[model samples]
Target: MTDTTAGTPAATDGGDPPDGSDFGVGEEGSDDPRIEFRGGKWASTLPLVFFIAWAIFQSGVLGIGDTNGLVVGALVGTTLGMFLVRGDWKAYADTIFEGMTQRVAATAIVAWLWAGMFAQTLQAGGFVEGLIFAADALNVGASTFPAAAFILCGLLATGIGTGYGATVAFVTLVFPAGVLIGANPVLLFAAILSGAVFGDNLAPVSDTTIVSAVTQDADIGGVVASRFKYAIAAAVPAFAAYLIAGSAMAGVSLEGAVALRESANALGLVHLLSMGVVIVTAVVGRHIVEAISWGLVVAVASNLLFGLSSASDIVAFTVTEAGALSGLPVVEVGETAGVGGSLYTGAVGFFPLIVLTLLIVAMAQIMIRGGGFEAIQTFLLDRVATTVRRAELTMVLGTATINGMITINTAAEIAIAPYVARIGEKFNINGYRRANILDANTSALGYIFPWAGGVLVGYQVMVGPDGLGSQYGPEMVVNPIEVVPYVFHGWFLVAIFIIAAITGFGREYIPDRASEEVSRA
Candidate 1:
């Protein structure tokens, strides 16, 4: 009988695995006690290799920058994983199931529930209008508009902790105005993405931030503080590019520019305190969902009692006629009340997000079961990563590669987290530094890859046939294929890390000898 756990030879120390065994891990046991090649290392790395190659082909060679290519990558990686594992297919299946159910599946469900509640609450509370007010209040020459827009969008995304949401908002509100005024669409889109990249990396409430801290066993504050440098380094250059691009794009000023200015000024103070509630609560280390829930309540109350919106109109916002509550009609608004409610908006916005989360989790499960994850991990640790610095680079490259295949940034982080933490611990790398590295790269690459959900969604909004592209033609927003060539920020961030790895710059606490000798909790 073959020993199923043969690939990775980890002695369960003095005790058996927590569930008594590895989820009924194959009954076959080998007593050889020799450093026998059970095939775990090479087995784990197989998925890594397949994903890297596939990502390059899909994004670089074939130039098919879509989710379709990602699905194909997942398939190829899974098949390769299964071919490497030396166990009964059933055992491999069980392991993968356990991994998915515990990590990705559980996290996604919670994230979506809170995501739905938060997104809906924000829309119902008129957050977007408030932003529009801000945009309208500012009337600058075309030259400085891009930089201002980029900074403002960055702030918005940082506050919301959702880059995709920020992208859609910026594209819809700022992009059109920029175009009408003769701003460079390609630079505008790049600026939007750059802002998003900043928030995704720095936001305390960001998914990548949460995963990196949790996986590396570091406090969120520490991780954020450590990563601040890298984010700034990448962002400054990107921001400057947008500013220069904005200046270069020529535009013909229009008549209603003054009218647009007035609308922005009118709603400038429309319950902005509601937004403050979210940012403050989040910074205080409260759970994001709970914070957003509080924000929602404050927004609704302020809208009604403060007369931000008519009471009847507020009611209309809760239940549209087309909804289940719609059939049981309630009061009318200023005229005929339209359907409205946080529930309505939240469900609409988060439905696709929930589906994406689940599908990605399932794909991850398939890769793990196929033995792809193990294949790659083993190969890197033993062969290429012969030193501490090499291991860190492996971590950086590994995070980037998985994200390209998975599309969901947080999912990719979770998938490779164990390996990252394990490798770091072996090399005495600081927890804070490790967490910072994980999040920085995850945020940077997830959007740059064409297959990434953020990129696809953003691309659709900016350049879809009937999208902003139709109204302005190619002049407004460049195609996804074209955007890749000019994604300087993405390339710059990657280069920064490569330099760090080679120079040992920004080294932090490397758990000392005394700390290293202590047992891992």
Candidate 2:
């Protein structure tokens, strides 16, 4: 096949560089007919596919929520990649190590530091109390509780700009409480995961959201607003499903509604500033990490200077928590209660999740570099994605497939985003539209299947010992795992995405000429 002149910018310049060099355009040899689909390419995808199947069997079919299964899946997938590649075993092995070092090793290090600081700070500031205050305000019966929790948790994550943080907070605070109140714990956990999914995908301050917009060369607000329809499309059904499940599973418990409300109100729960600070900063288009970090700083200052907690106490609390999570030694507390308190809790809370995410990303990088992604891309572009509808379907399927393996929705977004943009551009899809679709599927699939990092994190909370009793006060009924069968929201969200993609409903933006810009370098 001869190289044809690739499509040029439509009147808007599409943000392509002056030479029309974005999207790898003008790169010679990409269109070479002899660039035959290679065995290495197919082999690359094998690990990811195997990983997905194994994870699904472990989490969905067997219902074994342990991290052991995930570890095994990664190992098996890695082995398959090595076996399939025709290259020397040492090269493949070196690639594996390199992939692990580059993506997994790097992210794990960064996430640990960030998690340590954020968790310690938040714990010191009594972030849980903030959640408790919000939960108390809802005061809904079992039937409506799931929806209420979903919305509240979603809003919290969006405001906080940290889905993982929200997961930890909600699991620590809401999971046990939901079980005690006769709301299904699994359903409740799923609601929390779904909420986290929402925030992670759309929150201006969410890491995934930031990476998607910035990497795609689009403005953050444009990405968020353009994604509004896709997000809501998935969210509405998720909301309704939660409500229905809450009703059937909860069996009309309203016994402690008034008391919970009164206690929550008595705590002066309406301050809203911590949440407000994060949200407003995001809305004003600040970098996501910077905005959330600022919120953390404010939260810490509030705790110490404003007597949210004493400075010495907050410091000690954070140190203790960080040590526990990292499996590092926590020194004996000298004088401060709060500082020690926060650190001890935060690190312990977020460590496992951060590790899991890093490993998953590393495995994905291995698959990509090994050539599995190219095989799939070649096939999809040539056969499946031949038309606009098919291209969109390919987009959906591609996003879903990558998310299934990677599990961390945000990480999955980054893994698959280049393809989404590339395929969408082929069909002249809009930038805003592509960004919205990319994020929406990332959010939806991340919470749908059991292997998803978000779901497992929540699931572990329900089945674990501390989760069932401490988080929920007296006054409720239900076992934690029993709620999984009733986790309606996760299922509903997937359905919504499928329907919208098929029907082309509520799509607002298409890629413009400017979308092809090299905003990042």
- TM-scores of the models, in the given order? 0.70, 0.75
Candidate 2 lDDT over residue span 1-521, tens digit each:
52333466345453443321221112211332211124645556666678778877777677676665677777777776666555356765665554454432343345334444554565445554554565555565455666877887788778766666566556655554454445665567678877887887778766566556654556666677767766676688778778776767643345554555344322223224555665677667665455556766776666655555665544432232334443423334333433344544555544556556555665666555655555667788898999787888788778877776677776677667767777877887766667766776777666666677666665544444334334443322233234444445445545555676678764433433344342331
In model 2, what is the error at residue 311, expressed in angstroms?
Answer: 7.2
Task: Please report how far candidate 2 places residue 408 from its true position, in Å.
Answer: 2.0
Minimal lDDT window, size 10, model 2: 20-29
| lDDT of each residue in 164-189, candidate 1, tens digit only | 65565566556666655556566666
Instruction: Judge candidate 2 against the unseen true structure and give its global Cα lDDT, from 0 to 1.
Output: 0.59
> How much does candidate 1 score in TM-score?
0.70
- Please, what's the RMSD in Å of model 2? 7.0
- What lDDT is reached at residue 301 by model 2? 64
Give the backbone clash total of model 1.
27
